[model samples]
Target: MPEARAPVHVDGEVVASKRIGGYRHLTLTAPGVPERFRAGNFVAVSVAGHVTRRTLWVHRVRASSAFGPTLDVVVEARGSGTAWLTAQPVGAKVAITGPLGRAFALPKEAVSCLLVGEGYAAAPLFPLAERLRERGCAVSLVVSAPDEARLLSALEARRSARSVTVLTADGSVGQRGTVGDHVDDLVRRSEADVVYAAGPSHVLRAAAGAAERVGAWSQVAVETSMPCGTGLCHGCPLPVVGEDGVDRVVRACTEGPVVRGDRVRWDDL
Candidate 1:
């Protein structure tokens, strides 16, 4: 686990926030963060105090040949933590931490990549798709959302990919079931060599199962709320393979927010 450093005090004035049905797509510009941050990293922002640092993956690190760096984080305005995150005014001050966490196992040498995400899970994966494309890997994003409007963001992600397929629970987008339902067909048709997923435990489990059935390697980013972002807190221990198939605990804050799907002991959850 990394040391718990003091958060950089930043003032992120909300540039734009759109309500796409049940979720809010927020684009904030915080000037204090350094420009060297990669796409799949995250920034932890303080809401009330140090105990509850709101962790948000970098949805898109918006920088251009002309424009300055800006970060986009999707905030679901459904809970106390999220609701408070969305309610901040335009000029509100925010305390944010480093572009933490390791990058996903995306190798430029791979022929093609398949990315699967749900809700805020799409954040880090979105940037990964763009990076893979830049590295010449054929990227395909298959996203699952709850409704039609929520499908738009997934559609945008497809533009960066070689192709995109969307699945919605209500039959409003690409398919009428969970994204896992279409994994077999998508992999067969796209001939993707690697798979990456980030979302709830069930989603990762489902994805890992599907990938395993096809003999494809799978990786997932797990989420946990910890009082200390560093491993010393021992508050975010996740199950990992220890010896001869026994499960050992690893701190999510330090070892990973990202773990290979097959290596993680999901049953311990």
Candidate 2:
């Protein structure tokens, strides 16, 4: 967990909700709280009891000096949990548990960092890019979308990036292909020392393949459905390589939702 942590009782009142291409970005205002929320860390939200509070990562953390923490969560609206969140009005007070989980381990020897994401997986990466850039790492973002509007919006937001690339299955974005196509090209041409991926399982798998092929250090953030944010629930467990070269299940809540790419058997997931 993050060390500079203090929980102030707060509610996320929906400030703005809009659909951009294939995904939805919702902004919430949680007053009087220090906005130390980072990219890899997530917030647990409570809706009706029928649906358990799901942990959603911070896509962007913006807080006005006048107000408190303003959080933006992006969801694809694929399930009941996200659907309920999307249906909420602008002033709804949603119970939120926050700023949990470990951070991305950036390499000191890295030349350039490459981030690859797709769909709703783009959330945590927005803050991550800024953090990496602040650390003096050359940061590049490659997000995939099905339409041009979403692709362009993401690209425009990171206009200050050393390089911004977009890929789409449809020919509507920068490249008419999956992010893997561009990732392959970037790794080869840019000679990036570290690669990070967050998105669909298949997308991560493809990135892992590319990273392994090039001998670059790769890490992936795995999105798991969890019953409890704490590890006791054992709901979000993934098979990880043990010290004995065997497989052992580890809880995503505690051990990690982020793990070394090579340690994960991408094909099994």
Candidate 3:
């Protein structure tokens, strides 16, 4: 594992921005971000440098001499903060603090890994696929969305994983069904030893359940509203089952955004 650097506040310039289907992909040129960034880590952008900030998961990181390092994030303009973010033009400046929160812990041995994601939630998993492949793991992906137009990073997933399966609710894409509907079959077909997922609570619950059915270890990145990216706000707490079988609330910003799927109290989610 690489050492994690302290978080820093930096002014980043939007080097590139593109509208991909229903999401906006932005590449920001900022010094010292790439080296500190890890797959599954996120950045909190202070929209317009105002008090209002939105937390976004990192999609990719790269090196750049022009700006030192670059960070990428996929934004869905569902709210005012994201609307403002996606509307920024190239060369626009934004304040950001990151590589925040715990990252996915890759399995030590080379094992078949199944990654499941939905819509924009798939943003972080591509980077994770790169790391898993580097570790000699055979990676497969199951990406789900409402329709073909909403499938996030399908090309990227195909490029990164050994195999890719897509699912859509309206049958406008690869298959007609929710990811949960095919998770068990996918897990068995992939011969996956571990499952990693990020999406809505219900989807994650189904993914976890499917993994359990196959006797595979499951790691999940949970989604929640983060008013403060740091743990102080206590706004992103989720119920988790402790070793003693007691349910306790843990802040996603501190303890995890990635947690053991079996340890999470899915019913409480």
Candidate 4:
């Protein structure tokens, strides 16, 4: 892990915002957030009239864009908080606190990697793929959604992964199926040593199990209701079996968001 940096609270200006497929993508001029960001780190954005801040995974970070340093996040406007974020104008200001939570651990060896992503939460994996490729790791990506518009860009995914597999539930685009139906086969084909996944709970659960069956290490980025991005709220509890053989609950905002797939109490969640 890169040297950790303290989270900073800043009033950031929305540099760009657009609709990408079925998601809302935004770029914010967050001065210190991008400088300290790691692949799995996320930002907590203050909602206009809500006391609760929305936690969004930092999709991509730009050290310098036309608007200066910026970071991107993809949001699904399924709730009031997210809806407000997507509605922000270019010049609108939003309060952001980041680069928070534990990051996905990278491997020391140049081993083959398999990345599984579903929906907008797949946002973080794009950067992870770049980092893995930089280390000369062979990366295979599996992107899935219910339909074409819900899937992340396969064109962009191809640039990072050695291979890209697209799956859709309704067959509106790629393969007609869900991750559970095809992941085991993909893992066997890639012979991946490590599997990294991000997305909905069901997707993560399925990916984790497939990786385990293939004897591959698995790390999953989980999405939960994080009322506050900081650990102070103790609102986002994740049940896990600690290394000490103890079953405990940890704050997703602090201890995780990224955790060993096997250790999670998936049945409980």
Candidate 5:
């Protein structure tokens, strides 16, 4: 196990904010985040400077000579909490508590890695791809969305991975199906030794299934409703099957948000 760092509360200024298709991208001038952040870690952001907050996964961590270190999160304004974040003006101050949760573990040695991401879920995988490439791992990506407009970061994926595949539910993009529909073929073609995926429950299950079929290891980042970005709330628990065939419920906030894909009882979820 890794040592846990105490969460720090920082007043982060909105350095930049933009709307990309169905998501809003926010860059915050958070001082401690860049140093403490991990690829799959999320931050508890105070909404509208209120006591209420929302847990947002870290999208990117940038270290700039000019602005120091900044943290980015992609927001889908589905509810009031996220809507408030998207509405904030540039230079507005937002409270943040994070670099929380476990991160996606990279393979120990160089190997072929396949990454699957859906919509805004693709945000975190970019940093993971960059790190994998640094370790001499061959990285490939499959980006999926409902339509062409909603496909997240296609250009960025092309630049980061050795190969990029896009899928759209409407066939408005490269392929006409979910990433789940194409994952098995992608895994076989890439000869991927490991798989990492972030998206909806169905996508995670598919990624796990594909990895299992290929006898490859898999890690998945799951999205759940986390009222308290810590284990205390018991708001985000997922049933997992242990190695001993025991069933246990784990908190997504502390134990995961990232976990071995095979451990999750997807049907139960």
Candidate 6:
């Protein structure tokens, strides 16, 4: 495994911003950040006139654009902080600190993999899928949302993943059901040797359980809130069993954001 580079605080310029589905997709020129970016990494952006920094998934990285190296982020307008991020226009300058957190570990050898995601949180999985395909792994992706408008990259998944499956509660785009209803089938059909997932806690739990049932390894990118992305505040606590079989609390932003699904104390969290 390559060593992770140190995170840098940079003032990124928003080169492009677009509204896609229920999320805002922003492409920014983050000079130092993009080169170090890996799948499952996130950025902490300074919210205008706020003490808190809103963390967002670093959706993908563009190695060479007209503006130089850049990274993409998918922002959902939920709270005031996120709303501020989405409201930024083209050429807007925003403070960005990344690439933070441990990234998903790719298999050392070619193997079958399953990636599951929900809503806009699916951002990180796209890059991961690409990396897996490069390693000659059979990549299968599953994206879900409540409606068609919330689905992310259903069409693009066909181009990247060897197989694609979509689920929506309203049957707006694909099969009618929730992740809990279809994840097991997705796991079995993919014949996955490894499973990776991102979304809400419930969705991660479901994916983890399904993988375990089939005796496959599982890794999940947790969507926990962070007050300080660099682990200063120690605000986001994640419960997990240490290698010594002892329970311990770790900072999600530094210690994880991505962790072994089997190691997490799901019920405690």
| 116-166 per-residue lDDT for model 6 (tens digits) | 999888889999999999999999999999999889879988988999999
RMSD per prediction, one decimal? 3.2, 2.6, 1.7, 1.1, 1.5, 1.1
Local distance difference test scores for all models: 0.72, 0.72, 0.86, 0.91, 0.87, 0.91
Candidate 4 residues lying further than 4 Å off, grouped into runs, are: 1-4
Q: Which ten residues in a row have the lowest lDDT in candidate 5?
A: 1-10
Give all TM-scores, in the order shown: 0.87, 0.88, 0.95, 0.98, 0.96, 0.98
TM-score of candidate 2 on Cα atoms, chains taken together = 0.88
Report the backbone clash tally of model 4.
0
Tens-place lDDT per residue, model 4, 1-269, is 23236899999999899998999889999878898899998999999889899999888899888988899899989989999999999999999999999898999999999999998889899999999999999999999999888898777898879999999999998899999999999999999999999999999999899989978999999999889988998999999999998999999888889999999999887
Task: Give the 10-residue window scoring lowest on summed lDDT in candidate 3.
Answer: 1-10
Which digits, one per residue and each the tens of the lDDT, describe model 1 over residues 20-57? 75667677676645364565556777776436677787
- Candidate 3 lDDT tens digits, 6-116: 777788889999998888999987666677877777888887545657988888887765666788888999888899999999989888887777888888899999999
- Better by TM-score, candidate 5 or 1: 5
Higher-ranked by TM-score: 3 or 6: 6
Give me the displacement of residue 253 in model 4, in angstroms.
0.8
lDDT of 4 at 39: 93
Off by over 4 Å in 3: 1-5
